[model samples]
Target: MSDTGSYNAVTWLLDRNVDEGRASKLAFTDTVSELTYGDLQKQSRRVANMLRRLGVRREERVAMIMLDTTDFPAVFLGAIRAGIVPVPLNTLLTSDQYAYVLADCRARVLFISEALLPVVKDMVGRLSDLDHVVVCGNDAHGFKKLSDELAGESDSFVTVPTHADEPAFWLYSSGSTGMPKGVRHLHSNLAATAETYASQVLGIREDDVCLSAAKLFFAYGLGNALTFPMSVGATTVLNSERPTPATMFALMNKYNPSIFFGVPTLFSAMLHDEALKHERGGTRLRICTSAGEALPESVGNAWKARFGVDILDGVGSTELLHIFLSNSPDDIKYGTSGRPVPGYKVRLVNEAGAEVSDGEVGELLVDAPSAGEGYWNQRSKSRRTFEGHWTRTGDKYVRDAEGRYTFCGRSDDMFKVSGIWVSPFEVESALITHPAVLEAAVVPEADPEGLLKPKAFVVLRADAKTQGLQEALKEHVQQKIGVWKYPRWIEVVDALPKTATGKIQRFKLRDGAR
Candidate 1:
């Protein structure tokens, strides 16, 4: 845990909010309550005292399964103050998925809210390493009540003196291709992203109120909802409910946040929402960021046309923490991911590990201080993913001479459609441009000739899914982007399967589930 290359980020992230005289400023707000910077610090300290009293030691994993509320950040920051590694779990997971993460992390203690207590109890017996369950809202059965315990504790615990390289937290990857894997992150990682992307690129300030459609468990949301905001003493708007088009619109209208973060899927849903059609302009968002996947240029343009704000398409992974490459407000490339952020380096490498030419598609490798401590417990996967200081992002991209990047697809997402290689993103991007299509996901289906043919599952605009809409979509793709790039099969669906972070799960389509 003593691999120190940077400063203690818990101090760097939160303590400075106090020192900078933002103590009275609102730190976070949700349906339940609001907390100022002083209130957050006070609550976090109490949480730290409770953990220390319960014998939770330095670097021990303390898992939390709660919705996005004020208490979520309290317990999160509290665990870090005590030098415990807090593991925030995806709330939209099944019992088996919860069991795997609880046992895999060897989490000694788990904090669950009253709403999800039943689900946690169902799999509690399977977690051999879990010694205690600190219920957040109500009776704990045989476990302890976290609220009551914190109520008695003094809010004056000292922050632990942990080095920057010490593991501070864990976020499971958004298992798009397979089972989710735990990703270990250092205390310094948050600072790296805040300084480079949040500070240099987004220019978040103390007055900015940040709201993210993506939940906090995922890596992208962690930055948009907490780390990035906390670093600059900015306020964040949180919502306990799931992020639907309605919920996001309500949050934006209610909070009037200056900076808004959302994924492409939700953005498309907002575009198709009848209620939003009557709304005039962007609520209060001056800066809007899109990640979790490569956003289609068509969606970005549509949003810009309606809301009068540009969506900065960026790329990052669990392995690299948050966005290492992105487009800035001043340099919005409509169809391309912008240059690397200030604190990161990027290279496109070919199969033989040689740097590819600018226009050629190659695997993207990124180097940044925000990079994680490799995959948890999987030594072989860790070695392959973390190459020295660089992370093998497993994404293919093409860079132009101007240093702009265009995401091709996941290396595994490309296949031969008819004796020719095709990228699903290329076709899906084109499919979304059609007037009737709201969102599209393309997957390779095995054809009679043994070639992997492209098949599209599309969500059409409301009231646009007529009997002959499928044929229209196919014709549109053929006419706009090359005919060879068109999907051989098209199915109109109400929605596409997505991860907790709003990333389309293409693997499920490949497995014949969608």
Candidate 2:
């Protein structure tokens, strides 16, 4: 199991699939099309050859602004095959947001879907390093159509010989604190992530059909949908749009996938699904995993009761590439973000970098197999995060007596209310425990008295109303945890703000709280 530089994930899959005569075992399927591993390699090589023809060199940035589609995997793996670093951008972001990523990464070329041409066109003059814009369906100004370009190209490519430390791709942070920064992953980083998370933590089976609600632009989604299943020779479903509960449920029925990956927000939505109760379960999903944020125990228990499945959650950051610590099927703990995966170490430390006692909250630091090289261009942030080698995830956590890690909240998310530290998750979880509450987000806001107090925004049950529910929910927290932790004010909202991967955007809530 010695790590080597030549071991890249794509190459490993190509060799295994080809060797085992499972090259055509159908790696990717969507409503529109299906691609086997053989088809994946073919399209990947075609895109790689096309990139080489377009003069994409080693270490160049190839940006993709597209929804989750069949072509995404082709271009993504193709860029890596050609030794270019693929930077997948969220199609849902504004042109200005996309412009920031292009400028920050100095992306040389961008491959965008025609659906997003309007957005990309707005930033054309602003991007200095951008040389080409390859549109997926139709041609634009000085841009080639992906379909036309690949139509005549040969389906063969040479895998680039990359060092273990060589950058393979640059995925961006969620931009909760500021504009998203690019987190760079090396070639072996993908391989290591596939081996560590998929093999050890996920334990994905060859027969398992995997599906992810998170899009490819985000690291967690990309790993679950593309890298993990491909590395393990499993099948995956690629939904070409954002998934609503209904959409996801329909797809589950259509594909009958056994393993599902989603965020806590999505899981909560499914728990409220009336369709689940009426239709019973369509597909017998063996396992479901949650990431992007801590899964409230209330949500987990609700989903399990409704669907006969446990929503095992894990803690991960774009910086660490994927989930480094997660709960497996055998070791399911109801409330904790499980133990560290194989080849990784977890330590909870105080401000001075000293380890905290068990059950005490501290900043979480991870020593993982797939730690990114550093931020793409931010050396200062890089220095701040990388201690010797391990990346500081900036998340706060506690390890209990049983060695299970309980996620407290983000380090930056810990806010002071009346001179005391408060973890929003702790308060939010307490609020959701009320039967009338569907979901809740806690933020610190100043009261009329000028003292900061915890404020809660909640999504009530369909039969519940905001008028009486707010005061009761506030008192419920006081009765459960303490009177000090009770939210001074409560607002019932239809929904909460979330990132692309469905993590609560705490800073947004904090803005309104202020």
Candidate 3:
């Protein structure tokens, strides 16, 4: 796994699995079909041959709007095997976002699932760079069917000799604050994450089974269900439908997955789900991880008490690929994000570009081995985010004397009230500790005097009464954290706006406040 020299990620992730006598092992099981390690390699090779037959030259981009099925891994790895870059788009985005990304990356081919064809079917002809539209499932709708195309191709195409530093894939930012940016990742970056976080932190083994509630399009999910499992020839479970508590519990009971990956929102929802209360501890889940947002201490502790397993609440971004700072199973910290993984380094710095001391909040910067190369077209942004080896995470955090980091808020989400900075995450965490609150988002709102104060938007539990709940929640936060951090106003909402990855869109809330 050297940084230099010729290396194709597919060689290590797919080919080696078969070469080591794991060809017959179940590599992936989707809702519809199962893929063995033998079948995955063969199908990926066929995909490489089909793309070449369709005149998709080396290094050209291919956009994937498919779900969390077996087809996703075959296409994703196949493109990289053939030296083509695959851009996995979020399936939940609007048609305009798909068109923008297609045009932005100038994707030559689009491999969309049959279920998602209607989302961008009308705009297919409008994309000038798009040469082919291959549907993954049935009903091609006058377009090319992927199964038919692969049928005529050979399953033994030689993998293209690609450099470790060459671009292999692209993941768009979840765009919590603004438009999604194309984050280009190199071939070496994939193994770097597997070796650092997956191997060291997760301690993934070949016999383990994995299930990730996060979709394959997300960075966290991509690592959880695809790379980490594939790195050790482990099996993974994939579900196409939305991840509700019922659906997640059903999968756990059926598959008995050894590792489960989820976000904070899903964990909170599952905790409140009464119907599935008897299904707890039914799975073989030895390790659970959370990302996409900070896991509240209350939610983490309750989950552990019920499931008899600790949730390793970590933080990761699309820019760095996967989690660099995470809590390990041995060292469990309920409130703070755990120390950095063995291979990664983290630092918190102030506005003056100086490192902050313990207990002082500052923006976090990470020097990760898996850091992306740069944004696809935005040069200024790439320069700002990736400075030499250090990448700015744009997350505000405070380090304790013992070296654990606690999430404060995003850099733009933090605001000063009465000349003191107030963290939206801190207030939101406090609000969630209340028994009546299911989820909460805190944003700064201007008062009558033109001063900013914490304003909360909360989603109450199903059985909780709304009468006198706002004041109760305010007092609860005031007592838990401090009086100065209490929300000035509270709005009971059915749901908060979130990105595809389950991160609350706080900026959208701030926009409405104005």
Maximum-lDDT candidate: 3
| Model 1 clashing residue pairs (backbone) | none
> What is candidate 1's lDDT per residue for 1-514, written digit by digit as tens?
2464435666777878998898899999986789999999899999999888888888899999988889888999899988899999988887778888899999989998878887878778777888888987767776788878888999888788887878899999866566689999988888888889999999998889999988788788889999999988999999888888888887777778898899988887788788777664346778799998888888888889988888988988887889988999999987788999988999999889999998888899998889999889899999999999889999999999999999888888777655766778889999888878778899998777666778999887766747787788889889988888888888878788887777777888888832
Cα lDDT listed for each candidate = 0.86, 0.83, 0.93
| TM-scores for candidates 1 onward, in order | 0.95, 0.95, 0.99
Q: Considering lDDT, where higher is better, how would the candidates rank from best to worst?
A: 3, 1, 2
Total residue pair clashes for candidate 2: 0
> Candidate 3: global Cα-lDDT?
0.93
Off by over 4 Å in 2: 1-7, 138-142, 279-281, 416-420, 447-451
Model 2: per-residue Cα lDDT over 1-514, one tens digit each = 3355464556775557767888879888878888888888889888988888888888888888977888899899888888888999877777778888888888888888887898778667667888888887646556788888888889877788766677888888878667888888877777788888888778888888998998888888888898888787889899986788888888988888888899988887776776665544356688888998899888888778877877779988888889988898889887789999888998988998899999788898999878888887789999999877678988988888988998878886787776767888989899888988888888888888877788889888887755677678878998988889899888888889887777788788888877
Best candidate per TM-score, number? 3
Cα error, candidate 1, residue 260 (Å): 0.5
* lDDT (Cα, tens digit) per residue for candidate 3, span 1-514: 7767789999999899999999999999996899999999999999999999889999999999999999999999999999999999999888888889999999999999999999999998999999999998878999999989999888898899999999999999976565789999999988999999999998999999999999999999999999999999999999899999999999998889999999999998898888987777455789899999889999999999888999999999999999999999899898889999989999999999999999999999999999999998999999999999899999999999999999999999999988888999999999988888888999999999999999999998888987888789888988999889999999989999998788899988999988
> Which 10 consecutive positions of candidate 3 have the poorest summed lDDT?
276-285
In each prediction, how many residue pairs overlap at the backbone (N, C-alpha, C within less than 3 A)? 0, 0, 0
Error of 3 at 29 (Å): 0.4
